[model samples]
Target chain A: MGLNLDYKAELDNIIRDHIDMEGPLLPVLHAVMARFSHIPKDAIPIIARKLNLSSAEVSGVVSFYHDFKKEKVGRHKVQICRSEACQAMGSRELEVHAKKSLKVDFGESTNDDLIFLEPVYCLGNCACSPSVRIDDEIHARVTPSGFDKLISDLRSVNHHKARNS
Target chain B: MRKLFIPNDTSAVAMGSNLVANRFEELIKNKSLDIQIIRNGSRGMFWLEPLVEFESDFKRFGFQSVDLSEVESILEFICDDSFDAALNKHPKFLGETESIEYFKKQQRLSFFRSGLGDPLCIDHYSSLEGFTGLKKALEMQPQQIVDEVKNSGLRGRGGAAFPTGIKWQTVLDTAHSKKYIVCNADEGDSGTFADRLLMESDPYQLIEGMIIAGLAVNANQGYIYLRSEYPFAHATLNTAISRCYAEGILGQNVLGKKICFELEVRLGAGAYICGEETSLLESLEGKRGLVRSKPPLPAIEGLFGCPTVVNNVLTLGAISTILCKGSDYYKNYGTGRSRGTLPVQLSGNIKRGGLIEIPFGISLREIVEDFGGGTFSGNPVKAIQVGGPLGAFVDRDKWDTPMDYEAFSAINSMIGHGGIVVFDDQINMFDQARFAMEFCAIESCGKCTPCRIGSTRGLEVLDKISSKKDVEDNLILLEELCDTMEHSSLCAMGGMTPFPVKSAVELYKEDFT
Candidate 1:
């Protein structure tokens, strides 16, 4: 499939603005991934050529870090804290609940392209326990029922925004 | 007019301050009481958050976890001083936070204004001795500023106990016109929350410290590379920066001086390795949070090819205090070479899981038994991890070791981020050791070979040892791999992963063999 023009422009700008012009190809690739929702597979060669790095080197860097993604993500990304602090606060159960509710495993996007689920380390809100972030908004002390409500609410909001647009 | 400061921190809100705040506002409107309520950050008495402080005759009276339903009663008591025992809405623990032993024992240099002043307001910070350091720093040469910090003996609280003054001096000496100050706020250590508390409670202190660093180092721009996990902190810090800019605490010619200092918060996507300085820089530059090879240390060439002084949040937070209170005053608290108070975060299977700032040289025994009040499991304490997941697991036999950097290092352990996690007899040392390697394997940035593959191999060897498959052979192999990783890895994630694994194996040989 052809790349989205706006998305490509935005990604290029992010790469140019954030990543270094030379040396250490991994960080640049990582930066690209961080800016764009995902690292477009086609951009790998472009990034490699800019950094004077091998395509294998770029791919190696991209695949090494778990946070890097190769494909586009959903509109809303839900990251659940699976670190020890959250684990102590029953995140294991919450993780299971999230998987069942979302009908996808960690690092997987929903079929509807609404929400993508991922595992995060400590959110620094350990005192509250079981913290989850939906894009920029962090929710704490999330129960299974609360998780369901949160996902549904987010989905509905996404739908509303979609319709509005 | 009575001035009241109600903490708006999440910890405070979790303890039900939002409802209380609304009620206080309602009562003021209803009674037409001459009162102004300012929502500030908490004062570290986490158990007593939703802490309401009422200023009377320049003295602040505190009420913890004040319920909204009790607001009217509290107002009546405050207004009348009537002997309505039932109506007196005092917290479970009454009196000023300073009087509490948990707080009183702490010297609180770094966290001096935290939980006491409005984090987002520069006025509150200035009123509480914030910019005094920046003013002092600007008056002197960069070398003088560096000398003062060196005299204070303040070490990097970001795991490595390298002297802060030396680092600053090195960065100063390094020739680069476009120098940068990067504050490592990606505090992902499981047992640590000092950075988070500082960010949420007293963000201005961090800003002031950064401004001072910028002025001293002749840097124009800075970035606080905070973890994406801390959404609240991100918002709080952003608010603080805007306020600082408006108040001339940040931006060009800060405090009407020729010095120019600007700060921005860069959020790192979920990556534990970013806690490492090089990895943090990489992440800040919008790359994967991967470790970078040293020799061109961040001080010489860092953050988009500039001389950047990358410091831990606490290390920078402590700088303002050192400058404000004088190096001698700051250094007088701790023993040995480890000067000044350290904000030790007590967490994980401990009764009192919170932040406590105590003088260096305080024994781990005091922290575990006295401050922590022992393990939360109520079982006898067996082993405790002094640092984060990467730190060593010290058996109770070594509990008397002083919390100073020298002492911890002497005991084959480094106080990485001052995170102490207690574990009872129920904890299996073998399993804990395995978990450490597993954690490293999972979080390694894969920049270096030893860290990337060695961690996974270490885990496999640990599995062999744990399963008792030629346990002796596996144990030797584990040690060999740990040594290789320790000597070869680019960053501490690989260097220190061996600490817990090796320490666990050494301390509790019976568990593995």
Candidate 2:
């Protein structure tokens, strides 16, 4: 009950802050996604109500964009660039290596819910191809070995925190 | 005391600039060094980053690809009595930043101040002639400003080569209580980072350009619709914008004048269609980024149904130079109607790849071989995709074609957003052609049937051709599909999706068979 109330309070603050801005929907949705990692299903109606929009309109926006997540994602979200520039520099091979190592295809989370893999069109790092973004940090010139190191680093850091707690 | 410049640009940071900077700080402190480390923007030299530039006797020289291992030795070189000579003997030394042959052979007007000083420093910006354009624009009338832009021959750098002066003139002529200057910073091209570079490096230049645009169009408000993929640019622009506001460059009083111009940066959801003007406006209005039809062009009715002048980031960036140095100065560069330098992005399977800003008439071969230094894999170059995904793939035969807007259009290709993605001979053109169709299908806004359904169908037909079961029939069907999408689609998303596919089939038919 306490967690639910806290979540609701947070959602209300996000809607209230962005409601007065010009075209407040994307901003409100972006804020919600940033805070929650994914737009909570219940937050949609609340956002629509504050912005004088329909739930359907709000939901349509969430579905239309690839950034707005429908459900909870893993702790570490990995996006591999699948665009032509990255492909030209062996992104296809990188993508294959990533999926195999993660033991999951694009848009799937591992059974441990630690790593989620998705294919992003472009991250604007084309100058250094075969780019990968783990959460917010972008890694460039990423080979199979480089990817393995990145994943291991993430796991080790998280494991260290978990053990400390 | 000498200053050490390290790039905080996204590409530089991604290549571990932060790690090098941290190590350098530790090394400098331990050695009790008098050098200052400034986190500047990238010089568009990706291969040589994290490039560390040291100031010695009023000249800036760089050391390429500096990592943690070289941090201590670099500090020693910085502390050396004969700094320039010691740095020259250092294995990773790159002479002077501007005198490098790759950077020396080009024209850099819009990107004049990039990688020079701290991007966020207002004092540094002013010293480099940052707001001179705005000062000139303030002295001129609205019509005069528009006329100057028109005379400069500046076109929309986003994709369409539409004259910018005419668009501003339309907005200025149209009387409305509310007007807008929308800077299309939604740079979604796969092999392009010019917009990101400008925003991240010389951010105040973009802000100054937007201010000039707002003043010219009599629009008191401006919005930069930036893509979410560019988190670095978003943060840089926001910080630069806040700095502008604090310094009285933005908000109610424009540089203490009675005029008022406000600016804000709006983020785009992960939709490539939002790069389109109308779609960008729709997305800005907090709705699905569906493409709006023409007849009421964006110049007449744009964001929130008001008269708006939507210009690409580079086009707006050029406005400052044109206003400060005069239209004739800008018009002196480039050949034919495309008068000005274009910042061409060299990326994807290329050696020495980075940003190349040059006049329009430079050939593709000059760009790929001379500047880019050929493929990274050392393989024979198979094909090159000029522009973005919607751009055509040019074969070896077309390498000599001059890279102006007119020359490219004559060959069913375009220098769209000035992005050049190279592919080695190892790449399968059949797969590339299929990927273009698939990309369209994935990104189409579903507003038009031709782009939405046609893309999926086109992908399926390509897959069928790949299977070799009904190859001849599928090839004919693909051509028809390409024709339909080219003519019937609402916007470039649908209309130009066939460019890569058609060009691939024409140039590399062996891959298809």
TM-score for candidate 2: 0.99
Ten-residue segment with the worst summed lDDT in candidate 1 chain B?
B83-92
Per-residue C-alpha lDDT of model 2 across residues B11-54, encoded as one tens digit per residue: 99999999999998888888788889999988898888899998
- Model 2: residue B484 alpha-carbon error in angstroms: 0.4
What's the distance in Å from true for residue A123, model 2? Answer: 1.6
* Off by more than 4 A, model 1: A5-68, A72-77, A85-103, A109-115, A127-131, A134-165, B13-35, B63-80, B83-93, B286-289, B377-382, B424-430, B465-468, B507-513
Model 2 per-residue lDDT at B309: 91
Kindly report the docking quality category of candidate 1.
acceptable
Residue runs of model 2 more than 4 Å from their true location after superposition: A1-3
**lDDT tens readout by residue for model 2, A1-165:** 123778999999988898779999999989988898899888888888888889999999999999898898887889999998899999999999999998999988988899989998888888888899987788899999999999999999999999999
What does the lDDT come to for candidate 1?
Answer: 0.79
